[model samples]
Target: MKRILVVGVTGSGKSTLARALSNRLGLTYHEMDALYFDGPGWSVNSELVDDVSRLTAGSGWIIDSLGSPEVRDLLWDRADTVIWLDYPKRVVMPRVLRRSVRRTVTREVLFGGNRETWTGWLSREHPAWWSWSQHGTRRREVAHRTRDPRFAPLDTLRFGHPRDTEAWLSSL
Candidate 1:
């Protein structure tokens, strides 16, 4: 549990759980979204790969997400344990939608100071859309990938219920 990769569909509480685990276990907490996005207007940062490479070069860390495939291998290759928050799609979908709307309406600044806008929320390229669209695929993809022999070095914990996850996390 020293070097962990917290994975799940958006709004499945990846960031929240990662933060808590890091604090409780005294491990470094890295939010991958901060590595990929830059200041206001939500522009994509080119240094994402470099940032992730540097951050994970250490012996221990807990990262929130690996939304990009390029960085996925980097984290997956090094992680000792993976915590998969496999919450129901219906549960996550509503949470993501509500969070997106709240952020857009309140103009909350996120990673690298970027804030979500009403226009972006309506657009097909929005994070909300990405979350919803990627939901099903990610659920299946991560499940299958963890079972492959290539991932033998890693120990994965899949949680279909939040209570089960909490119990595991608490036992440390």
Candidate 2:
């Protein structure tokens, strides 16, 4: 599908799946975090909306998020297909924990040239903490949006587990 959005709770592999889909479908791939986070210190891009709007105006692309608050509606409105990774907290928590730990241990650079630090894990904004705290909320939000009339024209592919998603991907 063209103009795709990959949505899920943090660490649900949205980026991974979106990348694979983009490659397989030959569509341009856009990482939402890379678009929103500009430089070091996790600084935000002031032109996020404009940038997102310009990208979405194109005829084909795949983005790895529902978009930040300011551009969420625009993303949903323009998207033709939405792939929702709806794994349970049991599946997601360990993933997020391992990912954050690896990033911290390896000093892996991320969006905005930021790296996860041990001290940063203490904050509620940390990926592990955010994923654990917002898991249910994210699921509910995606669920509601999938059924919302405003996005009725959208086609949704919701996977409840990793294996299911993998099998579907392999098929494609």
- TM-score, per-candidate, Cα-based: 0.92, 0.98
* Residue-by-residue lDDT tens digits, candidate 1, 1-172: 7889999988898999999998898999988888777766666778877888888899889998745777888888878888999988777878888898899888888988877888787787686788788888998888887886777778998899788889987887
Tens digits of per-residue lDDT, candidate 2, 34-94, equal 9999998899999999999999999999999977899999999999999999999999989
Candidate 1: regions farther than 4 A off: none
What overall lDDT, based on C-alpha atoms, would model 1 receive against the true structure? 0.84
Against the correct fold, how does model 1 do in TM-score? 0.92
Predicted structure 2: lDDT: 0.94
TM-score of 2: 0.98
Instruction: Note the Cα lDDT for every prediction shown.
Output: 0.84, 0.94
